[model samples]
Target: MSNRVLMKGNEIIGEAAIRAGCKLFFGYPITPSTEIIEYLAKNLPKAGGTVLQAEDEIGAINMCYGAACTGTRVMTASSSPGISLKQEGISYCAAAELPVVLVNVNRTGPGLGGLGPTQSDYFQSTKGGGHGDYRLIVLAPSKAQELYDFTLEAFDLAEKYRNPVLILTDGFLGQMMEPVELKEKPTSPEVDKSWVVDGARGREKRIIASYSLTNEIGEANNLRWEAKFNGIKEKEQRWEEFYADDAEYLLVSYGTTGRISKSVVLNARKKGIKLGLIRPITLWPFPEKAFIPYKNKIKGIVTVELNTGQMIEDVKLAMDCCVPIYLYRRQGGMLPTETEILEFLEKQFKLSTEEV
Candidate 1:
């Protein structure tokens, strides 16, 4: 097959999952993200994979969890409301240490939102959306190409950590069409499946569940998982930076907003206002180190988001400073244009707004 093709973002993500050796997929149909399930249903079977249109979001996620427990690569995708419905299943996957790929094409709001792109789910996906002290590896892709590339990366990260991984995309990326360079079919690794359930045919039986009767045992399990997360945080942080080495002002963002912020940085630089951008590819083990070198040099920082100010808090926490952090956001499916973002930056940094 050719390496490059023009396709919808959601469809490309489905193809990327298949190429990543994902053989089992379970998802409920949801707007803006339905194309992914639709594509997988039509194509996965031909690739020797199974696609099940589960009864609901919960059923789909649980099915994914089961497949992951058997050491089979599995995936599920949904929009904002549907993802909320799958939260309990997601937490179960975390507790059971199942490696599953969960994708969320976010739309608007707290409930029954419209099919417009939004990043309001930032807090939900990154900061222990489900109950218990758990974390999911989160990836935010800005373009259709990253959407395709990140889907493949998500499976690898999931198995590497033996935990659920999330591709926190938005409706704009899901619905937009672009040319993407498809990855070559991945070669499966020599993975050890001895830990998986194989019906106890001669070997000892394997047990997997998230329940514990006593507090001591539960605390032990939690501590073990916490150690794994700390290791992951040390090894798996990924991000992108432009003009940050010497900038006086910095902009932090992810997903579509990050892409827009890049352009804003270029324009601001042309106007003689030294600006830089930090786009986090991994949201959970956030690219905290990306800010360390610039922490002392930057005069101020701005966070641009599709939501009001969810990610700004993380920026503050990561930088751990009181250096005049500001937020420019648009919610309820609205995206910030270059002019709006630049104007906000100029106003916050006290720069002249004219022609900048």
Candidate 2:
């Protein structure tokens, strides 16, 4: 019997969260991302869950912060501007070491660009969009299947690290439809919840805080955060490679553009161009390991994006400037085409593009 069912990407995220035992969801309605909350509102109750449409994005994220402290699996969703509003609260969650999942159905933006697709949030997401010296476990899921799989993975990653996890997907993927097989729920490493404030009567008092009484304590707290980030860096960097093992040029991209970049690599191959792709699934732990093998082997690296080269910076950092890197992108929700990418590579790298 075929269990695969067609579903929208945004709704898949909500369904995955529910199956993962998420109890509370809080968010303000925003284009693209609005479908996530909408789906949850209508169906989460069937799983004994509660969905709250807060007054605004700010209220919603803060509500997540409050609920998470009680040892609850909490989440929220929003678009670019709405995510911008949730930044302060997000930073608070990171500092307090709360486990929560967040979804950003990216739209074009510096501010209210449109309900179009854009990966501009790459820099904002991976580089602490929230203030302070903290990092979210950023997962960039490329297609509808990933939108479901990574949402399940996001919750486990959040609880495993006792930190906030962000599922970074653009409007195009969120609004698109695809068939996905609902797999068995994933199992995560047990998190030590001794700090959870779920009635301290059973043990001693638990203070879940992001502050310190003295500067010395504050410095110590900051050091702890740095250590945790370093640990995550060493253990969590993840990426996907398409023919990068043997290629002269590599295309770097993630989310929807990542899937497009794959087609670019295939098309370039048909023309006898030695091209490949490296898609970073974990944007924060930035997948520096993936670039290490291709460092000196490839002539150069090309980054594709729906925004003005935000991820190019990370690609450069990953390659450490040892290998030349280039960027091809379009801003304000414009997606790049396979033809455009091939032309860029031929023009810039002077690669042989013999027509098959």
Collision count for each candidate, in order: 0, 0
Off by over 4 Å in 2: 354-356
For model 1, state the Cα shift of residue 58 in Å: 0.9
For candidate 2, the 10 contiguous residues with the lowest summed lDDT are 347-356
Q: What do the candidate models score in CA lDDT, each in turn?
A: 0.91, 0.90
> Which lDDT tens digits does candidate 1 get at residues 150-216?
8998888888788999999988999999999996756555656677875889987889898999999
> Model 2 Cα displacement at 169 (Å)?
0.4
Model 2, span 56-136: residue lDDT tens:
999999999999999899999999999999999999999998898999998987878898789888888989998888999
Instruction: Estimate the overall C-alpha local distance difference test score of candidate 2.
Output: 0.90
- Lowest summed lDDT window (length 10), candidate 1: 185-194
Evaluated at residue 136, the lDDT of candidate 1 is 96
Give me the candidate number with maximum lDDT: 1
